[model samples]
Target: MAIAKGYAATDASKPLTPFTFERREPNADDVVIDIKFAGICHSDIHTVRNEWKNAVYPIVPGHEIAGIVSAVGSAVTRFKAGDRVGVGCFVDSCVGCAARDLDREQYMPGLVGTYNDFEADGKTRTQGGYSDSIVVKEGYVMSIPDNLPLDASAPLLCAGITLYSPLRHWNAGPGKKVAIVGMGGLGHMGVKLGAAMGADITVLSQSLSKKEDGLKLGAKEYYATSDEETFKKLAGTFDLIICTVSAEIDWNAYLGLLKVDGAFVVVGIPENAIPVHAFSLVPGRKSISGSMIGSIKETQEMLDFCGKHNIVSEIETINIQQVNEAYERVLKSDVRYRFVIDIASLAA
Candidate 1:
């Protein structure tokens, strides 16, 4: 076993503070990474605050992780010391099979979260990347291309993969009109990726506050969702509409924006259940569905695609101690885009 240092929220109401913990020693198939940067995902905030009402106290909340391989156990062959890598939302799965490059583990019955959940053992809780280091099986790690910087590339583990999976699944490509709702962390990445795929990209935001940023990020058009005319003008316009906002919205109205036989895919989790009128989908044969993050294979594909296209998140780097302030800013949607914690602050 190895001792680890990190920041954790003792309970829902308490802010995160420095804490000490343990990591399982590297097994022959495991790789130990010296965490470099950890992105502050909105999901991390929700879990720590017990907003989902299933949080485990003293939880270290982070899943978008980028790091350098510090050590590899004897059987590890995929990585060695000093390789750039990333770990996304999970560590292990329920299949009872442990091997390098586990297949589609995210959908398996025993899927384990990177934090606030149990490992495959159902006893030893799995912590996250808001720490000095992480020990994961070699299969769960991803290689970061040299072109992508550690800090900005960190969010791709969660935010990047989250959007990529849906876009690719829906075949957002040349000739496809795609609309991304909201302009926050997930929305911004969706714009970049959707545009890169040659889809005609549009951004539907509540306000025009980030319109310039949206256009610069590759959105062909940006609309203020607040304008009733905006929705009316764009009705039956998009082939695919991806709603990235976590807040409850008029889903039926958004569904009306899709063309006949078009699809509406949701990646964000709204606290409240969405009510959809039958007419929303009956007339056009439009489909409304949800997609989780990508499989490990697809995540690697997303990374490679991003690497080739010079895609990385727009992020603000902060010292680890500033996480509490960052969290508050994130909730207020005050961040320019994303916040990445510089793990060196923890080392200090």
Candidate 2:
């Protein structure tokens, strides 16, 4: 085992602090990584603060990871020392399950999260990228394109793939009118990817504060949702609407904006239950659906696509010590986009 340094949430009410833990030695199929950067995801804040109600104490909360390969086990065939790589939400799942066979391992019955969860062994706890190092299975690791910087690309593991999956699933392309609800971390990526895919992108945000940023990021149109006239004007306009905000909103009002047979996809988790009327769906054959992160195959596809288009998150970098402050900023929507932690600061 190798001793690792990181930050952990020892309890729900307290802030994260420096922590030391052990990483298992490389196995025949494992890859050892020296973590270079970790992106601060809103989900990380939720898990650390126990907002999700399933957090385990002393949890190291991070899944958007970017790093370099330091060592590879004898059986690791695809990666070698000094390779740029990344790891996402899950580290393992049932090896021979149907979901794995279908390349949807994220939904497998025995899926293991990268942190705040137990590994497949049932006894070993799985820590995450908030640390200085990690040992992961070669099958679960992804290669980062050389053109993409490790820091800006870190959030691609989670935020990038999360939006990419739904867009691809819905066949977003030329002639499609897409509305992205929110202009924060996930919303910004959706705008970039959706526009790159040839879709006519629109941003429906709480206010017009980020309208300029949204348009600069590829949105063709930006509207303030807080304005009643905006809703009235755009009613039954979009072919697809992807809601990326976690805050409570009127689901039915958004549903009314969809065209006949259009779909409303949710990628964010709101605290309270969303009440949707049957009339919202019954009228035009419009549908409401939800998407989680994508499979490893799809994630790699997203990375390759990003490489081709020179796409990455709009990020603000911070050192590990300032993570707590960053979390507060994230809650208040103070970040221009995403927050990425420079793990090298841990050694200071």
Identify the candidate with maximal TM-score.
Answer: 2
- Residue-pair clashes per prediction, in order, are 0, 0
Please write out the lDDT profile of model 2 over residues 1-348, one tens digit for every residue: 999999999999999999999999889999999999999999999898888899888899889999999999999999999999999999888888834375677877888999999988898889989999999999899999999999999999999999999999998999999999999999999999999999999999999999999999999999999999988999999999999998889899999999999999999988788999999999899999999999988999999999999999999999999999999999999997999999999999
Off by over 4 Å in 2: 98-100
228, model 2: CA deviation in Å? Answer: 0.8
lDDT of 1 by residue, 227-295 (tens): 999889999999999999978788998999999999999898887888988899999999999988878
What are the Cα lDDT values of the candidates?
0.92, 0.94
lDDT of predicted model 1: 0.92
Model 2 vs. true fold: TM = 0.98
